[model samples]
Target: MKLIAVTNDRMSIDELIQTLLAIEPYIDAVILREKSKTDTEILKLIQKLKEVNFNVKKMIVHGKPTIANTEQIDKVQLPGGLPLPDLMRQYPALLFGKSVHSLEEAIVAEADGAESVLYGHLFKTNSKPGLQPRGTDDLRRIVSSLTIPVYAIGGIRPSHIERLREVGIAGVAIMSTIFESEHPKNIAKEYYDAIHT
Candidate 1:
């Protein structure tokens, strides 16, 4: 299964770049999900990452098609409810992945031509405090229903990887488990090993 690292929006650009550099070897991709940062700031972040020789190709800009196009990064992870079909047509060069919270949403995303889907809060996580996790049964239903790749996200841990694989998910999208750790590289490697082994 693929091990994707998602930015938590809590780190400074420098910290993020350093973490990315350290974890790059283990992660399949990094989603730049800085919702509050301006487009200019996001552009600068990309530039900084490039300056450090981080692989821009592995970076997916969350909710920013124009920036992804500007940087020649071909991947963008879009939130649900947008006109995905129109966006796909507008940016034919870019590959779009939709973030979906439900099976209905996942079905719509697939129909709308999303290349992939990130679905979750599969386990209890601080990211969604007090919100019940969607759990494995729901995840399995979505996985079986969709023909496209489904990446499980939210509150995932190394211990959970085996169970996730059983659900037939294409991969896992992780945030706090890597980014919030004191030893980010080790944490990333742990997840990588779990998924691979």
Candidate 2:
């Protein structure tokens, strides 16, 4: 199982860059999920990352197709509601992954030409207080139904990796697990060791 680190939108650009640089070797990719950041801010973040010789290829711009195109990042994770076919047509060189909440959404996203689908909140999390988690059953169903890669997200821990692999997911997308930790490098390595070992 692949381990993907997601940004929590809680860090300054400098902190984020350092954290990402520290954890890069232990994870496969980083999803730049800073939703509140503007386009120019996002551009600056990318520029700074490049300045540090960060692996921009491992960066996936979340919900920002133009930034991905302009930076040549090659990957963008889009919301399920977006017109995926149109985006795929407009950005033929870029790879798109749809963020989905249900099996139906995953199926539709794959048919619409998404290279992958991020499905989640499979476990209860601080990110979604009081709401019920979608659970492994639904996740299993979605995984079994989709031909493209299905990356499970939300409240995931290194301990849950084995069960997730049993569910047939392509990988896991983690946010607070690494981003919120004081020792992100150690946390990332622990998660990576769990997935690989």
Candidate 3:
């Protein structure tokens, strides 16, 4: 199972770096979802990660195509509503990711040439409270329907990851659970273990 660790833009660069460092050793990719930081701030953080000799294997920048191009990260995970075709042409060199919430969206994303899709609400969490959990069955169906890689996102925990892997999910993208943990690397290790177990 692949692990995609997401960064919080609200945190200071120092905090963000610390968080990234803690989890980098265990995950397959680091997604910098900087929703509030300016482009310069985001660029500085990326440069800092590179400068420190961190092997940031794969990076998923939220939406900055121009900066993503110059920085040369692995991929760019786009928002749910953006046109993948238009952006794909703009950055043919980078992998394009889509945020998909349903089976139909997953099929559409694949048709639109998305390199991967992050599917969510697999389990309930504060991110989307009071909503029905999209259990393993739902995920299995979506995975089966799409040709592109499917990443299980939203409220994913170490315990739930193994089941996701059983159904052949490409990876898991996580936030609050890993990001808020005191020992995020250890938490990441837990996720890594779940993926392989």
TM-score of candidate 3 to 2 decimals: 0.93
Worst 10 residues of 2 by lDDT: 79-88
Per-residue lDDT over 1-197 for candidate 3, one digit per residue giving the tens place of the 0 to 100 score: 68888775568988888888777878899888988898998999999988877775567788787888888886898888888999888888988888877888889999999988888878887767799877677778888888888888888888876667779999898888887778888888888887767
TM-score of 2: 0.98
Q: How many residue pairs clash in each candidate?
A: 0, 0, 0
> Candidate 2 local accuracy as lDDT?
0.91
Candidate 1's residue-wise lDDT over 1-197, tens digit each?
99999999998888888899999999999999999888988999999999999988889999989999999999999987778989888999999999999989999999899999999888899888999998888789889999999999989999999988988999999998888899999999999999889
Lowest summed lDDT across 10 adjacent residues in model 3 is found at: 52-61
Model 1 lDDT vs. the true structure? Answer: 0.92
Per-model C-alpha lDDT, please? Answer: 0.92, 0.91, 0.83
Badly placed stretches (over 4 Å) of model 1 are: none
Give the per-residue Cα lDDT of candidate 1 at 186: 99
Write down the TM-score of every candidate: 0.98, 0.98, 0.93
